[model samples]
Target: MDSISIDEILGITRGELLQGERDLKIKNVKIDSRKIQNGDLYIPIIGEKNNGHEYIEQAFLNGGSVSLTQEKDRPFPEKMTVILVESTLEAMKALASFNRHRYQLPVIAITGSSGKTTTKDLVASVLAQKYTTLKTEGNFNNEYGIPQTLFNLGPEHEMAVIEMGMDHLGDISKSIRSVDPDIGVITNIGLCHIERLKTQENIFLAKKEILQTLKNDGMALVNGDDGFLKKLKEEKNSYQVQTFGINDQQSIKALEYVSNSSGLQMLVEWEGKKENYSFGFPGVHNVYNCLVAIWLGHFYKMTQPEIQKGLDAFVPSGNRMNIFSIGKIKVINDAYNANPDAMKASLDVLETVGADYGRRIAVLGDMLEMGDFGPAAHYEIGEYARKKADVLIGVGDLGKEICRGYGQNRNDVYHVANADAAGACLRKIIASEDIVLIKASRGMGLEKVLDYIEGGNK
Candidate 1:
């Protein structure tokens, strides 16, 4: 990040410099004391279990030039600069906001229950064909992660694609307001956060917050296939609205698509032209993600060939639709995260891609944070998996519910207590050339099964 003077930071965050030269410039900002570098500003966050204020001395010892503290009377190293703020988190957000607005580049903010990361990557790839772009890394879409991403912005970046994820109301509002995106995209509304949100309507309302701080001339792109987002096309707003989906009625629609174990190819109708596009990822759900990227590329006046090059260059993040072979068997490791919607989509991929293989094996774990909807969601996913997988291994307590839904009478269905047990069962039943799908929520740690398979078991 570009260096900023202590005076500017104090002015932007309304922080008072407890000790330091106002003219000193900080070249970088960090939250973790272990990551502190020379001339870096350390902002200690107060989390539930750990207090960052306690790490101030360590940060300074590690070459931190400045630190933000909530404790006003706290003692620090003799020469270390300290700033007192009401809250370091808020101060970081303020500083991030200041850093973001320094550039007049277009910011594309994406938020949804699922596919936000993939959409961000695709959009950034397409934009990169014509401009130097920056995109969020991994699942860093939270309040803290958003600011950290914005801190990396420099004069060399021509655009940014930010992903926003939320569990409570106002989460997206805070992030969106900080970035003030030129274009907002909602991938879809689903039951991923139903525990905190309560209902689909409430989730939609929460996701819609991304548009609250959108520029007046901005454009909102949504998945027209989603019943909730489809209504957005009718809403009157300060910005223009565009719909993209496989449906015939969308503003940008995929006319026909085909997916196999190899990859996906589709015919899309955009801007009064129908063209064939192919990307090396196999999932029907990804069609929506590609459509969003395609629309954004065309909006920026990128040539069709440039857009296709971006599409061809795109790569799925690890553990999300990451296809590979373990010996003779094919493994679709979509264990990054899951909900009912995502689980069903992955099951579809398992079914379609595993068609030529020996057997379709689905080793699924719990879908956590469903609240009252947990049991039914797991059971329904089991029922959905019946036709997709020849053998089903369910992990965790809720995973047992899946086996029950898959039917106890069938010997092909097995319920295990954890990933290890699931791995053991998989080793016994999994044959050479069999296709397997491993999926669960982030909390489930279902990726262990993949590790177990690769760890000399295969």
Candidate 2:
């Protein structure tokens, strides 16, 4: 990390240091006092439960050389250097914004209702083929996360892939303005955070705020297969807009498909040329991610072979469509997070791959926070799951809706209260050659069932 010294941070400070050696230079700034290291500057942010300002003494003891805080009347630590600010959080954001302007790297910002993290990972991997790349780590795509990611950037990094997530109307714009991306990518808008935004159109509007802070020469890469994105044409003199998808008119497109339980194989269309590609990640949704990365690779002038190697190197981590075999049963563990669109996509994968296999089963949990649409959305999953799978097991309160949707016609439908119960029943019911899919929101911890079915205790 190319760190700036305490003198440099003081130069950006709103107020003066209270004590300690004037010439002492701290190498890094940390918000959490608990993680403070020697020669580190800690920002005391006021928050719920406890105030960070109250921990300045502990911070100094933990080797925090300097402190940034709003309280001026607090007892001064004997030799601790203090940099007073009007507000610690605002100052931290300001420092992050200032640091962002110091880098000449291409910052790629990705956002949507779903797949932001996966898509960010894919694009970063591809870009890494040509540059020294930095990417946002797991779930660090929010207000604090965005600034933490920016603060980690140094002179050596040539490019950055930032995943921006927002639930309310001004959130995306605020984060984008902070990062000021050179490339804005939208994976696809879907039903997420509807409790605040209300409708899909509102979600689209909130997501399109990525354009608000993009550089004039930046590009907006969108999913062309998305009906909403397909209808949007670029305005003259605005930032460049490009599309990637399997259908619709797009600068990048996917052609030739062969998807099985193992993974995906397809050809990508880019710049009037087409090339075959193979990916370890399964599902058509991931194919769209590949097309986006290939488009970005072409943008950075990577040769076809290098781009192909980069695509092949990408892999899904944790529980994002990670396929594994337990004895004779095949399990598709995609229980990281769930929504209507993602559930439908997973069902599509199961239907396409289960043609000649044994019984196909879908172990689904409630899709939470849909507001008035929660029950109906869960029902939709049951409706779709019944068509693609031989058995459907629904869990949680909303799982009742899923069970009701499947109705008496589907004799294999079973509803359970939690993952442990579902797992116990599933272990006895599944037979050899059975293909099962486990999916639900993060709170449901549906992976428990996946783990149990694969021999882990729930």
Candidate 3:
């Protein structure tokens, strides 16, 4: 595949290109100086621990033609190019903005306090049925990750699905402007980043920034069931808004939903047409994700059969609600990440599935970044887990609060320090016909429990 020429890249003006061979052209962009190639342009981003500006010489030795820097020091040979900028990170955003316009692809931007990753994955999978699609990789939805994802797009791609995440104000604005999207999707705003944002209303404002930089013809796909998002009405200049929901009336709705041991089945109502769809992913909440994907599938003109096939074939990556049978044990590995809403959802699912099984266990960890509400929120979670879960295994300080809430309700409840302890305990306590649900924040790394239970394989 052909590469983006250095000339076409943003923030590469004559003054910025200080002391480089005029004939030099970069084949690709590299933020890490260590991975700089012969014709690569290096951007030195100032991060928390180390500064990329410190490695200009190493980048030169690795064969980079240009290095972007805010540092005043002239580290390289006089002949080599140093792209000077007031802020290398801001310049990176500018570069990403230029690339977004250059490609002019139909972009779908997804943001929310919850379910952004799952919804993005579902939309990308359905879009792939009819379009050459590019999607966000992992949780790379921040300032640096947005630029990198945009630059990774090649000529072969027709649609881009970018997931935007934020912990504070203005993060989404930077992310949205970087990839001026034609379709904006807000999965649902919840209490995920309450530590930084302070209130759900503030979180809604942050996520709505995706619409601020939207292309003229862009459409906003919103969750009609969410009270905060539902309050946002259409203005004259407002992009055409579409809504999706399970019970609440919406543009696209899941009229009736059903789930069993195998998977989920739902009837989606769109434009007065009701279609029954079944997905491999199990959950009532996943039905909403399925609706969004189906809407996007319709937008891309995918046939009903292709959309159905795609939704049915969809499976979550990493640890989002993955079910495994270890010997005689049924383990629900939903350890990708967790919040109050998701934890409750998983507990409900466990309650439903565990009713038929012998025993139910909830192995949970701290839901971080909850600010002052952390302990109380965890306690509420513990109280609910006590009622729904037969055994509760807690990890970290926040989890200790959850265990405390369970109080003298004494069933099988234990608070451990880390995932290693949780994993070790699982090996001993977990047995035949037991159903276990493992969940925690991304930092908790509770997937280790899955590894331990699956014999380090699943």
Choose the strongest candidate by TM-score.
1
Tens digits of lDDT, candidate 1, 155-194: 8999999999999888888777788898899999999889
State the TM-score for model 2. 0.93
State the displacement of the C-alpha of residue 421, model 2, in Å, after optimal TM-score superposition.
2.1
CA lDDT of 52 in candidate 2? 90
**Candidate 3, run of 10 with poorest lDDT:** 6-15
Q: Which candidate is the best by lDDT?
A: 1
TM-score of 3: 0.93
lDDT of each: 0.90, 0.82, 0.82
Residue-level error in angstroms, candidate 3, position 1: 8.4
* Every model: Cα RMSD to truth: 1.3, 2.2, 2.4
Per-residue CA lDDT of model 2 for 1-458, tens digit only, reads 35656667667766666666667766667878788899877888777777899889999999987888788899868888887778787777777777887888888999987888788888888888888898998778887778878888888899899899887888877677678988889999888777678899999989898877765688899988886766556456377888888886789888777777667889777878988888776678889888888888889888878877887777675788777788988888888888888888888777766664799888889887688889888887788777888888898999999888877456698889999888987987999988888888889988899767877784
lDDT of 3 by residue, 205-232 (tens): 9898989976567788999899887776
Candidate 2: misplaced stretches above 4 Å?
A: 48-50, 234-237, 353-357
Q: After superposition, which runs of candidate 3 have C-alpha atoms over 4 Å from their true positions? A: 1-15, 77-79, 234-237, 454-458
